[model samples]
Target: MMKLLRLCALLICMSNAWLLQAQTTDSISKIDSLRIKQIIQSGSTGKEDNNRNVLLNAANNTSPRDVNIGLPSSVGGITILENDLPVVYFFWPELPTTTWRQSVGLERTGLLKMNQVALTMGDLGFAVNSYSQTGTKEFKFKSRFTTSHYGWLQGDVNVSGPMSKNGWTYSVGAFLNYDPSTYTLGFARNAEEAKIFRAGITKYFDDDRGKITLNYKYTDSYNLVNYALFNYQTNGQVRELDNFRIGRDSYILSDGAVRFKDVRSGEYYMANLTGNEVTSSSHTINLFGNYKLENDWNFKFSTQFRSSKAARILLPPLSIFSTNAPAQSGNTYTIASTGERYEGNVGTQLAMNTPPTPLTTVQGRFSLEKKVDNHFLTFGLLEQFYRVNQFVSNRSFFYQTAEAQPRLLIGPNTDEYGFYGYNLGSEYHNGIENKLSIYANDEWKVNDRFNLNYGLIFRNHIVNGDYSQTPRTPDFTLQNATFTDINYSWYHIGGSANATYNLTRQFGLMADFQYTEQNRQLEGYSLPEPARTNKIRSPLGAFGIFYNNDFIQLISQATFLTRNDYLSRFNLVNPVNASEAVATTTYYDIQTIGWTTDFVLNPFKGFNLHYLITLQNPVYKNFNFEAFGVNYNYSDNNVLGVSKVLMEIDPSYEYKKWKVWASFRYFSDQFANLTNVLYFAPRWETFGGVSYKLNKNIDLNGRVINFLNQRGASGTVNGAELVTDASLYENRLLTGSYMMPFTVQFSVGINF
Candidate 1:
């Protein structure tokens, strides 16, 4: 088609230009041959800037070229380029083609399509998106048409240039964006998602002898999620301790402690945690920037101003307690009492009049980073001002959720709210997060055959929220049992490092380690919870060799890793002396060690092969109040296997005429999982696709995703419906839940 011919023509021209550039590079360095280089490089040997810039440009190809002066697409066919091109950085680059840039801050881009490979400087870096994919839920059944997903579109381009004439190096950048809005429900339901458009301009100032910049961002994000989305909803999500898997039907939990399991390990872990609804709105304009002094040190300063609001809410009337459940014949009991113990046994849900919920949060962060010849370091301070309509509710609720039922750890009683009650409307949170981090990285180059990259990151966080026994409230006002009318803080520090050292032209070793220590901290409890130190250390590594010729290229890697998880709930009869009375009813920990391998093969320019393998040893430590359970601790270990393969083919003979890409995976993680109960993950999630150039101005694309049948009447004993799975899925008992039928979408892009 016409599109193919045009693409082929561009390729030919680019190929010729490439030859010219190559010949030129051998002749003389492009930018360095000029004046600027002699200064920045001072007296360096290698005058390489053309190819360097080209390669760097390719790595940063995220922008699209503009067509006209300042108007929308005016051509009926294809548009022309008039402005700068986007720079993109790909994980792997075998083919030089144009793909749309993802959202500003998100890993996924927008759904819009464009044919012209015009690259333009992207929006300012701090812009947000205002679109969501909240299907049947957002519009309700009547208005619902098709399911949609949303993302916060953020990204910026800062082009700083050095002017030796005026001894000034200036950076001019701008940010434009639209961010989505979302809301969460209290129980087992999902929240609604929306979006808002924001725009801002920022400019920096600096001189070659010094580095300084002053920047500001102004934005108004509308249609954000608020109290309305929370107070009323037909169905919501659930709250639990751990291990909840049901696929799509799984509550679309965001930040909840429990959630559905993906097709990864045999069971759920942190990677699978969801079920939190986030809804925020405000006008934020920050005049913030940084500067570097002549002493090789940097001093950064900034001040932010903002207006924010939240929806009104009622405090739920429920209390959590650790009491003996009805004794069954087979049930085990370590305690003599058959009676239940509670922190708040109030029988009634707060029977009070309702008023709209309102709260505000204003915060700021300041930091400094020092650049060492071989290291990069930074430290900072944070502060936030919060004003909430009700402090009593916010203070008491955190206390109960963190302590009330220190024994069962989790059960129906805990779900009802508190450890034993259901009303949670009473707890409100208005807090700020302040944190700092210092990090350093080094790229070691010994010779042409080997290279190594090492880094270390350290950080600390401080959070402050308001609490009061007699805070302003329309109803549900009671003496807060714990720290009412006082401010508390939680502090934690974590660090991580990754290293890669090449042994040969195509072979090397890589490793990473991260540690987080958050002990001696108090969480939200009916009373301040016990302070205990917990640490998580994870290390990952891989080694591989590659063989390559023009016709065929192959790579194989051996990957290994280890991870840890820990959780402990405390029980205290007293409201204040939390540290001493801590029963330490349950101390949970999970440790895992595993290995994985990946292989990628390219027989030709248009075709590629990809594969992966993973093996692991996972152990879990568990304890619960049930007498049948061990009062001490028990660790369960299991091994699991996972593998995958991907393929893509683009015919050179056809030029840009027709393109096809397909990926299939054979994955089985159950072998290493220890799940005899509860619904787990799927065995596989496959993908396939094809895009053809019907003509020069129009192209067609189609895809069949998640080919395997996972939504069958499978998995759990009772037949459960697939929640938000793929379009086409096979339902198998014990298998994961299926989404919908098959989903097929066709998009068209035209360039004149």
Candidate 2:
């Protein structure tokens, strides 16, 4: 921590090594607007040293950027942080968005819906949105600023002397990010705090045929604190539900005062136990590293290791509502989660709160890749192990104030309420994965008559996790000891192929096909085992043409995508999670297809046009996490974007000296989670700014985004929230991180 503080202190006294916008009348009057094709972006280096000439317009509009990844960096190339998504319906730097890596890579490593993506223009990259508030009240937005926005300060120092002559570079790099908007799930008053550090080294060896790359990275989002919010519709509306089991049956809580199982328990401790401990320090440290080989003929390897431990204060995976179980209407109830005393369901809704569990995941990764001539081949063999020493709560203060009911002491022995708190004391998980793929790609330059650019991909995947929940269980109980004994294996074979033949210089014919098959099975006697298989795909066939002006730089392609067998990571769960499998014995499948056309036209100077039209039908699948029943899926997504040179409105202003632009988009989901309801979210994202002469030695500039703020829906979803039909009240949330409102920023700086 002290090291980080010291590093931050030095930043105020230092200036970046490079500046992107060096435009000035004296600098260049002849080169006004840069062509679209000329812009370039280098991910591994500084600005000018790795520059491109993509002109950007200030005062830009809001629109969903294309998800395509094959386009050069000038188009779109932003990574999303799924854990923290923007509040608005559009893209926000802090909100959850999709990562661009999936659009191009053969594999995805993170959660599917959590990452936030950024769009880039030329050497500059930024995201815009309509709503920007992180909370569930009012709308607030942070301006879109390049350079300092998610940009990392990275470089390496190589000290190999003459050995560096062979390009044998051994390097080290570090970067830090401080964003108040990225903190606390917006539940707390303060923004989420994030800190990241990365270092790596490379060795060029074996005549350049083999280079060794090693890297270490760490990221921590901590010190997050938020108070409970009490803004029910009309304050004391008290929409309550009682989930009870009359007699011996178990019923989900919905209508208040419902009965539960035959409540039973052992005598509680009669002695007073007052315990308190304090130490000056507590922390969690995780160390991770990976080794990679530089090879071309299909050979690669990588390994990783990580270990972590947390402070003792976070102990106790407890929640308030979990403590109060029906006590036969008379017996003293010993609560495990919240110790708050309760007579009935009155005055109780006010105290209801979710569990506060903090996790410590220590994981490792191993991967390999290979390619052979016309056919590309890759394999990822991984063994990841997680060591969880203890489960802690981030809400210890809340628990401390509610000790009215006999509370549960963290330990081995406990009742039903206590057992829930003892979900997992300490355990380790060893997950193994094997993934293989092969593809053939090539572009046939068949005169000016016809052209073909396409390939095929085949993949096979299998995964197994070896671990257990709580190791200790009471005797005579059906036990689930070593999860290692329960095996889950899923196999998948997928491939994609496309061909585009140029019929004329202004038009072309193209078609593409994709297919995937997945099978899942579990191995265990006590554990239920189910085998299931599913095949999914997207059939895209389209024909179009375009003109290219290598000078003004204009190109366009109008093609259609017939999306078939659309699937989500969770939706594609072969056998689904264990508990779910035992309940349904069936899998979730999305077998519907949709068709959409995307057109990109960049004509004349300093202008570009992009639009998409999509239509889809409903399909049968489980909605949300609940296996209530299968239903048809319905929805539509439409997007459009246009960029123009601000200077075009006034020739007096040099194009390179000033800029402005705007984009807009709309998305409507009639039935969210396949439930019967209309959910619509519309967004207008825009960015506007210009460079002004603040004297010969200084310049003034600024930008704004999420100006016309509006969010679709936001609410609670922490397991129990489902009891009161929380999904029904989702649209009532006033603030959300999904849509950060619009805001503007201005800054003046010296040229030197």
Candidate 3:
């Protein structure tokens, strides 16, 4: 068994280092021992070094490790390694920033509907670090610029080097970004712009034992536009739905026709309105430090402070009425109706000088890590403090078509029903939380033929808070009601355990188990209900086996998850068959089981292929919940937005200076909502691109994304505004994320 293991390791090392012509025997001996150690433990390291190189100008002596051993980098890149008899050479140019990694990966290969346009922007950045005197005094610097066709731009510069001859190192970095194409759900006359600024400074002590960093950032962003309901006559004429009839006789079927109902159905339409401009700003300061202690121990500490202010504005996207139209006009539709619409009144209006929301927070963390022989230990503590205050008023106007009910009028002379008006309200909160965690792991070599790894983490979290809010009343006056104060406290414990064992030279087995609990306090908006604790418990376990060789690898895993006390969103609905909406809370239990298989093949030089498939079954188990004072059952139903099957394939080929690659993804049909009122059909997508390295420091690339341009009904959404009967008063249009059309993009950059 020992001989077999040594042979397998030797074959893998030879194929990766010598077969690729990456390093000669003499050069391989000169390679840093640290680099070789990382490669042997992780199987891959140079690819991750590319991403780490982009984060700052200073190049780390050790390469970063990959999160998932066999997965591709979030941002695509190419790597080349070569070592002569005296010098080692490596180049990895295509690196994605922290932000671009998430956005770009999803745009090109994500399965769900997403804002592809917002995420499709391309970036170009590179850096080089050289160590003189055999890795003693390193000097490095970098520059980057990114832009999109939609009026977005980002640029940054970073530098790092020895500050003095006394063994002190320093790094400086700054960045500026402007984006005028921030997308909004609704239409806007002028697109809102977002601006950001960031700067950081770091100092390293002698012998690389300790380091400190200070960073500052500021951001300003805008919200989306607003929409409203309108009344458009069949003659292509449009008018605002602002006026209502006082009696049944005041409305007629047509112009001069006999009056039968009090309202008209065919006249209602919807239109986008220029929403008020709302801007939010945040300022943050961060200070961090790390120190290495004796006996292979390490210590880390960090603190962060943030201040944020929001514009004095109402959430205009949530209008009084929904986008859906009604089924029946006043007369039970003597005339054919267009469809159901969500219109509460002729028009919805906002009050000026709404209170702005202000927030301040402070966060701190401390951790220590130590390694004693084959055992590793870690402990950490975290603390957070937060404060928030806000006052707001949203005035919705509805001409009283029906007689004014008890205290329905806003004023004595006013004959309007503010059915959707959220009267003067305020929220004040002061919250704090503390958490402590400890973890230990062991890597044991039981024998020449067997290796084992096991670990576990234990954590506790405690939270306390004081919150208050004003109840609603008639006249939309704050003085009419008093503030209601509430206090909350909770504690929770969580843990995880994992184990891995080697069965043979090329075979391995692994198992992992996790248990978590959380106590959350839900904010209250209604008078009867104050903030309440929402307890959640989630437990998960997984078992897997894998076979790895020099040229091919295969892994299969099965996972089971159970959520015992899951909290749902706070739903607002009209339970009394009224036009107003009331809030309610719901909870459920869910269970899921999933199986995943991954395959990687490198049958020949300069060619690679990867395939992954996942089969999952998620359902609402023993789900019984209440909404608007009514109980409902939803046991054994498939979870919304969770597909039964998902698949992906990635293939790439490289020869000489040219590289070509393609990505394919597929998702099975799934339900859009819990009620199963709408469903989405299966979708398949393809993306292909080509890259050419003109030279070591320069490259050009082009991609044709969304090649299939698959388009159809993606999914559906309930009306923005909840009503008594959704079928009678809600719109039924599928409103999930829309697929991006076929697009072509090109990028070129240099690394020196």
Candidate 4:
């Protein structure tokens, strides 16, 4: 009884404080409006003028504000003014009190509960939010834990405070979050536990004309499934591929031409229950600064560096055991024992040593902007460098001794190293990539009726790497592929122009054009081909008209695009000639045309509706390529995986303290390859959510993430034809795979 009384008293006090704050806001708003009018009449619009700055600040009530010093709260917190008194705040102070409704913003909706809000006062601000939820999986599989049941408990905290209040203003803040992650995707067998931490400091100098900020973040995550477990634990899928059974307790790749399974593990191969966990750690630092120079010029710069390491403790897949069967024909191989046609390795159960992987990146950007009369100009430079080092080892065995029919050797206690006949050895790779770019843009307003914006960019990329694959002991008939100094460099130039002309306040016309000449880098496949031209020249043009008013908006656009020298991959018997045998790259050209329309309606004060539709046609416009020992024409063919139609509708309503919304997305049938022999059915997905604010500090929400339960293949595999021995191999569309099934989640959050 005493605790209940205390809570009631606290609620009363808060309500009173909020009411006073609201009254104060109204009075201040009126005063500020009058002051703004006076300043405008006086023509005091200089950027360095204090009254102009105050007027600008007042105009952007929706703009993001820096967190309070020493406070971690991100919610609508107490905002202190240098002159005016701070107002008491809540989850949605912007909403009218009589409506008893939170703002329509997604952050205020309990159903989504995707963000945290905070309040701040003066140099001190703090915000906190936390939630716990349960989720069930679509697939029912048994492993370390049943795939059906999952749950997570997570919490976040943020704080900020003034570091110094001298001529140079300074502030510092910290944020932390903890998540016991669950298998919301239904692909991984294990739940992850993660801890994230970040800290930042900001300083203002040059009479508040410039500001600089430095931030650091660290993350530690554990209990992730390793490669082997990921392959064996998921249901009906192995290593992100659909598992197919060819015979009783036997299976061959159903999508591809490959025929074989790891017979050694028997049915339902049990992954190693121990030492199959993956752990990852990352550290990142960023430095950003912005300065306002003389003559209406502004400058901004930012640099970021990150390093990450992941350790995997699992064995590699075993090698396939194929006998020296009679070679029936080209692109065809037979396993002498099983009398089965084979295209790829099929075996399993190897005690391979695991290794740690390392990755690093450095990125930076600098920009300068100037405003002169009715024109805004900007110039920028960007750079990024990335590197990775990895080492992998796996060994498989095949025994065809006089006493035993060529059987794969594997087991929990099998001496794989001692009885290895074909020890598929280790590999090492060191890779690096660097990209740089420079660009300039200008936005010009010729008059009240017309506006134009244009920009051009120049970019360059350099990639170099070293890779080596050790040959299997006793030489397993596979040649060792190694490159000591693989290198590639490419450059590109791109430009774009956009223009808009206003016929009246409610109607306008817009046009856009873009062109580019680019050479794409063939990542990881550094072996150069003399006959391949990896260059592409693309141009796009669009014209559109739009109408906007107090209650409705509509926009329509028609676009035409073309690509020259588009890169395409092919398998050649020879790299130099199509008649020879080797894997190679090829080039082609493509074109596309599309039309899009979007409509938005605000029929009432608290209701909104949006509709969009798109129709497109894309086709290849050139040449031929060889794969699976056959040449095929692709001219005038539909571009692979391009859809012809797309549509979406979203509607929302808000009244009192209730907020509700629903959305739908649709896509037409799409082809899988240029041949147009394979296609996937159309897809439809639906989503909805409802939220209610129970009080100023608490909210409740429910969301239907995928209420329709639509099931269809999400993606296609294009290499099945390359692996087939027959001519005109059709691309494989994975069956039984699907987007997320029907799901509902509910959340309750307490804001402080």
Candidate 5:
């Protein structure tokens, strides 16, 4: 409550300051209204041209596969933001619903609307505008329906028009999606669903110097949580079981269910895995305005408030062990349901349930820009506040591993709680965070052939939180616990410099450098002993050359990035005793050296090709930690789940009324463990699509994903973090995620 009052006070102060500044500015001549209108229209389009940033390559123009996660492109070898503040208030443990990306009048790249070039892991300080359209009075209606082969259906409708001739406009959009799992799992099919709605209204001033927009969005969604199991081969490869297809079968049981204890209340509950899925919902509102001030100064401000309840439920595979091995009581395992002896491998899975975490967030940004002779300057302030009430619980179960569908198993002493295995624990966290930053940027055109840009930022971050954990007793019942307060604060100062020099009419050289220092996030506070409050330092440098002409455009860049004081939690098993496991929090460092090349070739009038290639060497450094009184080190090990080589080739041909395109992507081998013992082989994915313009208002499209039927696994292997010797269990079973199999999709769209 105190935090809320403080936030309100801060906002009120800022508002008063803005009013004072606007009222004190001297009278000035009216600006070019037509140019201002053009700028507004361009902002709404969400596209940028002639950007020379190495990270903003043409290959990144495609829409992201999952906006909830982030863009597919990575900066400095980190794909996702460390915190959710830059995107959403919170994210689901399993899969969350898409946010602003699905709204009408929004850009594919969220930064485009803000006139930003790119976002990096160390520099995720940006504000997102919801939906605002201005300029000419126009009306548009668009609707699309899509169906995939694996029982996936999606529909989207968007409408925007002038509500009044006197400069009022409105936009409304709805998105619905239902996706079955990639595999043909009978019970868990169609286990994911999402429904999102967005609405916005804009009022443009008659003088065309200012506009105000108000936007609202609501989202409700749920997703299935399951992965595939594989067998590790002696040759550092993975293979499917005899009866189980790698990408065609699921390990989830038809009658799967979980029993867990609620963290808030000391009550136990049985959650059915079928129709009673955990659902999540969120509501967000945004108010934004921009105006042309005196003396050619432009002012922009936006504020967003959101409230959400995020829920998570998943059955994740933990570890695999031979059922023939002696149990804690020197007895073999048996089927709990059928009372039959089990002789094969058995996999331990965890039933994790995080019931509806309530969260509230408020974000605001204010900026002023002015153009001077040969230089453009911008000053901005960003503030964010969020509070989260979180709770999570985990219960363990045992299943006899099989070629196809696995069967539940139990030992001689099944727990009194009716669990096949023991209960892990339940945890509760109540936290609030506040962040404020002040920044300034300048773009200088030194000459026609040379340009320079730079920015500096200073931030103060504070987190106040309380955490508690309830452990299971000998009888598998949860024990009562009391919360402990945890508070911390950190300061950050970061800067970036970029320069471009034109060598010739069609060629240019560009270079950039960025550095940041800040403390780790609140995720580390839940540990038994809170993680060290160390500052994380990140540095990135890049140099690139580009050539542009009528027929071809090419950019090749090289980058070097290093990050220190990285913290993470890993579940490690004792090498000597497979059953002895512990979750430990550790710190490490990462270094990456990479090269990327992108090409857009239009050799002829009707054909175009977009080719991109990336090569990177990312490694761990000083990665030493202790767990269970044992010391371990993984220094200089290759990072897991990051391929050294990646390539994509996309080509399209456009005829009078028809267009066809195909994309081919390749990924080199990648390690699956920090020890670099287990790895997956190279893989290829192919996609092709054809679109027909039926008329001015209608279009039809069809696409095929994974047309080559590639069957390969991706993602880190569960419970393999401590496996330093691959030969110890060459033929043992492991679990991880797999690539989706071949699928077809068809869509029809109507636009007016």
Candidate 6:
């Protein structure tokens, strides 16, 4: 803690000194509009750099999250969009893990476009376009090879040029990535691996004002699921284990395979934990075009068709207890395939697997825009269709707890089916979803000192599906079950209004308000009888002031947001006994009021500093649920996985052909569970890098992640939902995820 404080103080002192010196200098001038736009778009004053694009958007003051790694990201506590379209798969608004990683390769992207508006008229009005074309005619070729300290290697090659003299352009790229986990696992060769290929062709017409492009992408990926287990005190302080390093050791077993019946088919099969990996694949095609019309009018259209398959294989810990506990007697725990008693701390884990499930989707959008006087108006339509066939099977297994490489165990209660208890063949879902949206927006310049923007949107959502699940009963068996039909529909209307007033050439004031309505998602259809509740409503309001100069630029804003009717599901275990558990669904609401400030300081020549700070109170309201035939109310609890404060400071210096930069991010304490009793301490994630432009066609770069080596846990605590009271769980064991350890990466880039 002291070290972190000292670092913060040092940075602040340096910034103040630089600011004073810059103010007294006679070389400073007013910042130009082009430079301001660059800062707003890339979060830096210098040329675009992938390493500096850490914050998703400077306006919201939030960072991007990796959905593949079980992290959820939001813009002002709301779901974000991709290319002005919702990225929904099943119930969540996140694309399949492999699809995102493959489509957005490390070195394939030529440009990143972001549109942020304080309105709900355009599908959240905050979207990121990551797949824009290069639009280059001259020959261009680029390749990069990167190696990490942990023996991971990644590489990509891209080339684009004119296919023919008759206005045809083409591009092709390939990427390969291999990443072992932060901690090496004895049972797996690599924790994550991926291969991606992309190709595109474009034809220009009407002097480049009109063009059509067709693109194809393919991705194959594999990943391993793992986490860390530790003990915690009543005060929410984590306890270190004797032989296990929190961020440098893994507890997955080498011989943890299990036999289980398929959810859709009754045939039995053995699922291996070693050598074999969970794999997924995807194929995507995109067709898009835009044309400029006469009389200041324009037209644009885009369409996509995708067929993909996703695989799931997880061994999530449910509970941990001592061997001498009351629940371990009477031959309750024994060595796997044997009758010998097992002695040690034991962890109950759910071995869950789902065969590669098929998914197909088609989406299209069309828009028209016109400019009249000081007003710019746009009208658009969007349509999407998705189909998914999924099946999941689960079995319970016991393992002796250790710092690394545990051994599986079986109990007398284990049935002939090779599972200890409950939910043998878990779930099956076959579903189809359709969405249609119509929206219109207008931007008007009221005067030289005043501007106004407003928009309205309407959306229709529909779902049709068949679902079934096994009952959570002891000694359950895989039974042939029939599926149930599910049919539902919803209508939504939303809009926003925004205004900005420039008081002077260097200062401005702005305010905006937005509102939207949400409905039940398709994932809820898996239940035999889905819950019927009021439409979830979300409302947001913001007010801010901005100032810009040659030495520094700043924007400070205060925002209030409220969202209700949230739905979630969890499987909780009895703390006293590892054999007993319950599956539950919960409904809740959240309200938050936050303040955010973004700063871009060019205090001296060739030196730039970008800083952002966010402080917010995101708390639950009317959070009530039922489990074990008991009602639990946790109103006024802090929202899980959300910190009250977030800060990012990045500073870079450029001199001739050499550039150096560092980024420091700090997250305050966050609640780890619904009860708000378990929490993770504050932590810092620091990164530093240096690059040398060795001639115009070659570059050398080196980067270090977690350079400060702060080894702390992140994400939510596993299976702690039943611990509503903290006093009873003092000194009890807990299982959760840990941050990545320190590592270094070096890369060589070649371009011609």
Number of the top-ranking candidate, with TM-score as the measure: 6
Of candidates 6 and 3, the better by TM-score: 6
Cα lDDT tens digits for candidate 1, 1-752: 35323433543354345334433432452100000110011111121122111111100112222211101111111121100111111101100111122222111222111100100111101111111111110111111011212222333332333434433333333333332312222332322222322232323333522222322222221121111000101111112223322222222222232211111121222211111112233443333334555555554433333333332122222222222323222322221122243332111111111122233323333455564554444454443333333322221121122221112222222233222221122333333333344444344443454433344444454544433333222223333323333343444444433344445544445443334443221123212323233444434334444444455333344433333434332222222211112223244444444444444456556665554444444455452332122232245633212212212222222235777665544333222112322222334444455778777655665555444533322112111111222111122112121222233333444322
Model 6: residues >4 Å from true position, as ranges? 1-52, 55-95, 102-127, 132-135, 273-277, 337-341, 390-400, 415-418, 422-425, 469-482, 724-731
- State each model's C-alpha RMSD to the native: 19.8, 17.0, 17.0, 18.5, 8.4, 13.4
Candidate 2 lDDT, tens digit per residue, 1-752? 34223333332122111011111211242101111111111111111210111122221111133332111112112323211121111121111211111110111122111001111110111222111011111121111112223221211111111234554343222223233331122122222233334334445444444444444444433322112211123221221112311111111111111111110111221110111111011121211212233444333333333222222112211223222334233433333345544332211111111121122222222233343443333333322222222121111111212211122322123243332222111212323333343434444444454433333444444445433433322221113443433344444444433344444554445543434343331111111222233433333333333333332212222322332322222111111121111112223332223334344445546555444443333243442343435332333321111111111111112355554444444333322222322222323334445567656655666645444544222222111211224343342321111333244555554322
* lDDT, model 3, position 184: 22
Query: Which structure is stronger by lDDT: 2 or 4?
Result: 4
Error of 3 at 287 (Å): 2.6
What clash pairs does model 5 have?
none
Best by lDDT: 6
How well does candidate 1 score on lDDT at residue 656?
58
Write one digit per residue (lDDT tens) for candidate 5, span 330-381. 6677765676677777666666666766666677777778989978888888
Local accuracy of candidate 4 as per-residue lDDT tens digits, 1-752: 35323433543354345334433533453200000011110111111111111111110111222221111122233232110111111121111110111111111111100000100110112112111110111211111101111243334433344555543222222222222222221233223444555556666654556656656656655432211111211121222333321111111111101111121111112122222224446665655656776555776666556555543322222222222323212333334335455443323323332233455556666677887888887787766665554323222322211111122322222242213322233223456666677778777777877877677777787766655433333323223343455477888777767677788877888776766665543232322332233656666677888787778777787877777765543322221221122334566776777777777789999998887677877777775876556776778876654567766688989999999988777667655434555455677757788989888767777766457765344333222222222222222112222343454556565543
lDDT of 5 at 348: 66
Q: Is candidate 4 or candidate 6 better by TM-score?
A: 6
Error of 5 at 410 (Å): 2.7
- The TM-scores, one per candidate, come to 0.46, 0.48, 0.63, 0.59, 0.85, 0.85
Q: What would the per-residue lDDT of candidate 3 be over residues 1-752, giving only the tens digit for each residue?
A: 35323433543343344222312321342200000001111121121222111211111101221222111122212111100000111010111121121111010111110011001100011112211111113665545455544434545544555656765555444445443332222233233334445455555655677665555656555422222222322221223323321110111111111101101111111111222214556675655656776545676655555555544232221123321335214411111122232233321222222223444445555566675554455555544444443323223322221111101112222232222333322223333333444444444444544444444444454444443344433334433434544445555545545444557777777665555565543233322245445656766677887777888777677877676645443323343433433334455677777777777789999998877777777778776766556666778876665567777687889999999987776667655445554445666656678999899867777765567865332322322223323353233211123333354445564444
For lDDT, candidate 1 versus 3, the one ahead is 3
lDDT, ranked from best to worst: 6, 5, 4, 3, 1, 2
- For model 2, the superposed segments whose C-alpha errors exceed 4 Å read 1-163, 182-190, 203-212, 222-430, 458-460, 466-491, 519-586, 621-654, 685-703, 711-737, 743-752
- Candidate 6, residues 1-752: lDDT per residue as tens digits? 35323433543354344334333331232000001111221112111224334332211111233211001233122232333333334422113445544232332321221113323233332223345343347888878888877777878788888988887888788888887756667667677777878788877765656766677878787666667767776665677677677766777765546665554555566776542325777787766666676555676666666667666567777777777766565555666546566777777777766667666666766677787887888888777777675544444454555446676666555565436554442545566777777878787777777777778878888877766644544334436455566687889877877676778877888776777876775666444445553688877777888778788887777877777876665677765555677667677887777777778899899999988777877777888987766778888887777777777789999999999998887778878887787788887778889999999999999988788887667767787866767776677777787766787879899989
Per-residue lDDT value at 296 in model 5: 74
